[model samples]
Each structure stands twice: as C-alpha cells, then as structure tokens.
Target chain A: MTKSKLSQQLAVDNLKIGSHVYSSRLIVGTGKYPSEDIASKAINSSGAELVTLAIKRFSQQDAISNILEVIGEKKLLPNTAGTLNAKEALRSAQLSRELFKTNLIKLEIITSSENLDPNMPETIKAAEMMVKDNFEVYVYCDRDLNNCLKLEDLGCVAIMPLGSSIGSGRGFDDLDDLILLRNKIEQILIVDAGIGVPSEAARVMELGYDAVLVNSAIAYANEPILMASAFKNGVKSGRKTFLAGRMSRSKSSIASSPTQFLK
Target chain B: MSRIKIQLNGTVEQIESANLEIILNTFAPKDRPFAVEINGEIVPSAKFSDYSIQENDKIEIISAVGGG
Candidate 1:
C-alpha cells in the first residue's frame, strides 16, 4: 500500500484519553443486560477497550460480580452513577479508587430523576475535586459548549456531552448545538447517554466524535449479541467515513456518470 | 453496654458493638471483599479492629453491586 494510506491507518488506530490509549474507540457500560452472561457476551463482542460499571455497596447477599474477571484486559471504569451532588460523588470516587485501583473516574452527578440530566454545579464541583486528587476524570455533562470548555480548562481527560437525558433512548436532534460544542472544545469528545441504536452511535462518530458510551440500548435489546456486533461495525464505519471526508451535496442535478461530456 | 445507633449503608441499626470490626461481623458475611467509611472517612482494613464506633457516628459499609 501507499505510504500515506499506511500512515493514516496508524493514526486512527490509537485513541488517546488522558494517559490511557486504546485501539477501540467504543466504550461499553455493564448495565441493563438481561444477565451477566449476556452482558459478558455483548461486551466481548462490542470490541470496546474500556467498560463502565457503577460502584455500589458490596453486600454478601447480592450476587458476587467479578466484572474485571469477565471482561478480561479491558479497563474497568468506575462511575458515580447515583450521586446527586459533588460531596457524594467525591466520596464515591475516593472509595472507588481504593476498590478499582484506578485513577480514572467517570463523574456522573444527576439531580432530577425525571429527565436524569446531569447537575452542572455538582459536576463542576466534583471535577475540581477529582483534579486535585490527581484522578483522570471524564466529565459526564450536557451539550452546552460553555460547560464543556470549563471542564477542558480544569484538566479533564475527555468531555462527555450527553446526546440527551441518561437512558432516554432519545436521539439527539440538536446537531447544531453538538457541532458548536465539538468545534469549541479541544479535548477528546465522547457523546455519552441517549443513544438508542447503532445508527445514533454512527451519526455521532460521523460528526467527528472520538467515542460513545452505550449501555441500555444494547444491553436491553432482545438480541444483544447481534446489536453489539452492529455497533462495533457502526463505530468503525463512521470513523472511517469521518477520515475519508464527504462529497458536497447540491439541490440541483449533479450527475455522477458522464457529466464531463454533457457539461 | 449501652448501644450506639449508626447508619450502615443507609440502614439504621442499634448495635452493642463498640468498634468497626464488630459492626462488620454483625452485618457482612465473614468471607467477602469490602470497604468501610466512618462519617465519610474510609477506615483501612487494618484499622477496622481499632477504630471505636461512637453513638450517631455514620458508619457506612459500602457494598458494591453489579451495574454499569
């Protein structure tokens, strides 16, 4: 192959988030699957380098879950799923550090359960604390450009803007706002939450997003294995398209065949 | 011994116990991986036997569940 083609392939092969570099850009979450076996199959098939799990009380009554053992070699990202404020989120983070033994924390602080939108004030406060602790934090936030910029300045590794509310299955129609945020931020951008299908994930990647974190959509699907494969392909196809660039569209007739002779 | 009330993972329990280890023995199964926090301070495993539990001291035994 040509030198340019080989070099371009190598460049897209590695996705860097903070100090963590991964070959696969898609990050899967270990939630909402019918069972652990199904979750394991889905995760393994998804080809995701990093997987997210909510850190909760470790009770003996609860079935023991060795997710680290299940998804072998994949980075275990512990998130503050149920935290409503900064203090709670920080406590969860500190505790998770002891358990997971990783500095990476996905800061998820939500106030309203109805829409499950992230609390900006709480998220910002928690991000500051995580930074001070030298934790490589990924901020789960809204698509607001200003909030993303603020997080980027505070040494966050990646800025994860929700496609919509968490677990809504609602697709992001406000592509303009997302575009604005994407253009404004220099940090690695990941569209987390509200992805209903593989197409949604593909659309986000086609818009130049670095990665996506999918859970409910795939996990809750009737056929998670097939869905996972679709997502893996979707992410790869979208990334390739983004690198390949697109042809301009026109309202008037633009013939693809024998246009030179006709014109 | 006069018992003290502490919230363990958000559950209120009246225990005759005086230390974190006694509390763990009361609630958690003997063989399990876990962590403890007393009023938001995570007490290391070694300190569980020595750290005395006082009245109304929010001692939380965080139990991890499988979730994403």
Candidate 2:
C-alpha cells in the first residue's frame, strides 16, 4: 500500500456498529432538551449519524410533535433505560425492535435508582435474550474488563462502558481501566455517559476508544447546539491525535539545543 | 352496539368495539410511528385491521421518546 493511503487509514475514519457504517464517531441522545426544536438542532450540529431514543407509551398531550419526525435520516438506537430486571429489559427490546424497525438495541438495566449503575447480571440476561432474538445488542456496563469481555462473547455488536455513573457528569473515574479495556477488547468500545465536556469526550477517543456517546452533557449545556458542535470537533481532534501517536512521557528534562555553548 | 373495557397503557378505557384499528384511530396520532402490543404480543400495524381485542386485554401503544 502507498504510504499516504496507509497513513490515511490510520486516522480515525467511519464508525461501524453492527453491519451499518456511520460517518460520525460521536453518538448523541434526544433527552432532557428544553424543547424538541433544540434537541433536533443540537443533534444536527453534532453531526451524529446515530442517536439514542427511548420507547414510551404514546401520549397525545405530549405528542404535539413526534420525536421521530424531528430526527431525520439518522439511525435510531433504542435503549432499555427504565427497565429494572431482565424480563422488563427483554420486553423493552422487543417493543423497540417493532417501533424503530431496527435490530440495534442498547441494553441498560439499572437496579438502583439513586446511582443508576448498570445491573450487570440483568444486563447479561437481557443480552442473551436479545442475541437469541436476532437483535444487535450494545451492552452498557461499568468499566470492568471481565464484564465487557463476557458481553463480547455473547455476540454483542458493541460494548459501552460508562465513564462514571450515568448522567453524573463525574467524568472518567478510572483511566487505567479504560485504557486496559481498550487494549484488551477487539469489539467496538463506546464510552457512554458521564461525559460532562468536550475534553472528556476527547480523552476517551484519545485512549483508542471507537466512539463516545454524549447525552446529558450536550442537552443540559447552556447552549446545546454549540456544545454539540464542540463535542463533534473534540471527538475528531482526539481521534486524529491518537492516530498521530503522542510523545512518550519523560521523567527528566531533555535539552533540545546543543549541550555545550560556545564560550 | 356492545362496548368492551380494556387496559390502555395501564389505564382502563371503554371502547365501542373490540377492533384494534378503531381503537388506534381514536387514541393514536396518525402522523407518527407507533407500535401496538396486546397482552405482551406485538400486533403489526398491517394486522391492526384484522386483529380483535379480547376483554380486559392489556394494550400498549408506544412511540419513540427522547432518551439517552
């Protein structure tokens, strides 16, 4: 291969989730926006090819404008966010498949209401059920390498590890674990949740993660549209930096000029 | 005309008939995409006209909502 061609491939390119290829590596969500107008605008500014959504009972009062109507041409990734057990998660997945007409399902089962941490056992069960049902599962879990590996073995299309508790905005709690997971797994790694700013998103991408899913960060920002744009640039910059390779850390200062100066 | 009572999104509602299509026309927004489930079984939109709802059948009409 030509040097330029090979170098171009090294730079972060399109993202592949399951069989579908997307141009953007950042995935935004459609929740917590002041209005549907802002949400659509933010998503558009983010340049996200895929967006996350939830399945809820239809309510005419709240249905003045449908969420599907605003989000045009982007792939929908329906998540089982409210489910507490494997059974509920499975039901949500099934219903999402029918509603969105897509096999992509973000499996998130949280047991505790306060922490909103993933119920690993329940997530596993739901992943198994989703796999059996022929859905492309993206399992969300803590930054535990073992758990992520297990999900990969279950045929999950993606492994989404939380940077911290969902929506806490605490940022990455353990950088070591994240780097370790990146080194250990071959499946698509997406750092989901707790990304408060563009820098956090960039850091995750710099660690060689395939993608970063930002929701509350952009939605709650003072300017959702602007924050969305910032995140888009952040993800791209970090990916390019990663491909360029960073300089090694040094304990002692090294002189860039001649050691001896003319007296 | 006979009426049937069914649970709609966890609330009991009285409808004129047991037909799924009529019930949807009354409750669902025609412009949006939605999925119907009766007693935990998904009824495809194409089958709505032919499907009959049983008494006390738990029905849920759902659509996409904002979430992350």
Candidate 3:
C-alpha cells in the first residue's frame, strides 16, 4: 500500500468514538426488527461492534428482557431520540451511562418533528454537559457544515451529520455539505440517518466519512440479515476504494482513440 | 430447606427453594437490564424450564444498565 493508502486505512480504523473498535465502520441499531431473534441475527450478521438503542419506556419493562439478554455481549449505545431540550438530553445521557455502563452517547436533540432537525443551541449545551460528565458524545446534527463545526467545537468526540432526515433514506442529498464537514472536523465524522440502502452507506464511506450509523434502513428491510451482510460488504468495499485513492475527474471525455494511426 | 444460591448475570444471590419463576420475579421489578447466568452458563429466558436450581449454584444476573 502507498503512504496515502496506508493513511486512508488508518483513518478508517481510527473511527472509534470511545473504547469500541468497529471494523465495518457501520454502526447499526436494534429497534425496528420484527422480533428479538431476528434482530440478534441481523446484528451478528452486520458485524458491527457498537449498536444503538433508543431509550424508551419499553426498556423498563420485563417483556424485552429476552432481547436484552441476546445482546448482552455487544456494546449498547443509547440515544437521546425524543429529547427536545438540553436537560432532557443530559438526563438521558446520565441514564444511559448508568444503565449501559458505558460513557458513549449519541446526542440527538430534535427541534422540529417535521424535519427532525437538530436544535443547534440545545445540542451544543447537551454536548458540553455530557462531555464534562465524562461521556464520549456523538452529536447528530443537521447536514449543514456550520452546525457540525459548532458541535465539534463543543467537545463532541464525533459528529454525526444527517444525510437528509431520520429514516428518510434519501441518501446524501447534500454532498458538498458532507464534504465540507469531513474537511473541517478533526474528530470522527459519521453519516447518520437518511441512508436508505447499502449503496448509500458505500457512497458515504467513499466520501471519506469515518463511519456510518444506520437503523431503519436495515431494520425495515424485507430480508434484514441479507441486508445487514450487504451493508457490511458495502462499507468495507467503499472504505477500500477510498484507501486506494480514486482518480481525479476530467471536464471532457478522454477517449482512447487510435491517435498514433491518425498521426 | 437449604439455601439455594446462584449467580445472576455475575451477581451472587441466595434464595430459598429452587422455584425459578419466583426467583426471577423477585429481580424483575428492579428495572435493570439484565441476563441470567446460572452455573457459569447463560440461561435464556425461554429455557428457564430445562434447568432447576441446586443449592449453592452460582447464578449471575448481569445487568446492562450500569454506571459508565
């Protein structure tokens, strides 16, 4: 491998937000599976080291004890999914830390239900508080580069900029913004939400993102295990492609015509 | 009756009698994310029937919701 290729590999390898090491560079969630068994199988098939779980009321019930038991060996990441303010986000972070025994948190402070857009001020406040409390914060922000930079400045260990919106599956609607965010932040940059298919994940990886966090895309698939495997392969292939260093694009077509014969 | 002790997901607990449902119900109300580990082996909630508790058998009920 060339120096640039080696660096690219190292960059992919270094996407760990805290103590977790994920080879696939794609983190999945366990929420939307039809059953716990299927969810467990999908998670195992995905080969994701870290998995996200939205902290909700059902978690407190005993009905899902079996599900929790199945995922005992994997790292459980709790998200502040429904939290609207900094206080709620902080409380959720604390609860997650207490329940999951891990300081890693995915900060999601939504300001509007329609767009599921992040409240920048609330997200910044929550990030500051959670980081101070010794949590490795991964803030999910808007696709705007400015919001991502602001979150990075607030001490977030990683910045998860959305591609469109949660579960939109639109897939990289703003490539320029994502590229700018990747360039501006020194910390980990993960493409979270709005990814609809495996190719979207591959595209994000190809764009030099550190990782991709997915949930509904895989969970809602008709064949989740197969989709999980597809995502795993896509992420790996995309990372490898980025490491190999893609050729620069040309404005005009360079046809391989018989130039020598013509001359 | 002798004291039947077991490990619940790594935590040690002593309960009287070998009734599985009662023991599980006791710990269920705690609202902690846990899994039952009996005698160094994981006992899925579905298989709570095949194995009966013996005296002094270490039962570990591991809780996922622990302080970071």
Q: Which stretches of candidate 2 lie over 4 Å from their true place?
A: A1-6, A10-12, A258-263
Q: What lDDT tens digits, residue by residue, belong to model 2 across residues A154-225?
A: 999999999988888899899899999999999999999889999999998988999999999999999999
Q: Give the TM-score of candidate 2.
A: 0.96
Q: Give residue A179's error in model 1 in angstroms.
A: 1.3
Clashing pairs in 2: none
What tens digits encode model 1's per-residue C-alpha lDDT throughout A1-263? Answer: 46698667857678999899999988998877887788788999999989997766655556456555566677878899888999989999888887667899999998765657899988998999899999999889988788889999999998999988787789785778788987888899998988889888888888889999888888878899889988899998888777777778789997768856756
Q: Which segments of model 3 are wrong by more than 4 Å?
A: A1-14, A58-65, A112-115, A255-263, B1-68
**C-alpha lDDT (0 to 100) for residue A78 of candidate 3:** 75
What lDDT score goes with residue A126 in model 2? 87
DockQ ranking from best candidate downward: 2, 1, 3
Q: What is the TM-score of chain A in candidate 3?
A: 0.89
Tens digits of lDDT, candidate 3, B1-68: 67866665345677885876667777653544544555545566677655678866776544432110
Per-candidate Cα lDDT values, in order, are: 0.82, 0.90, 0.75
User: What TM-score would every model get versus the actual structure?
Assistant: 0.89, 0.96, 0.75
Q: Give the candidate number with the greatest lDDT.
A: 2
Task: Return whichever of 2 and 3 wins on lDDT.
Answer: 2
- Residue A165, model 2: lDDT of 82
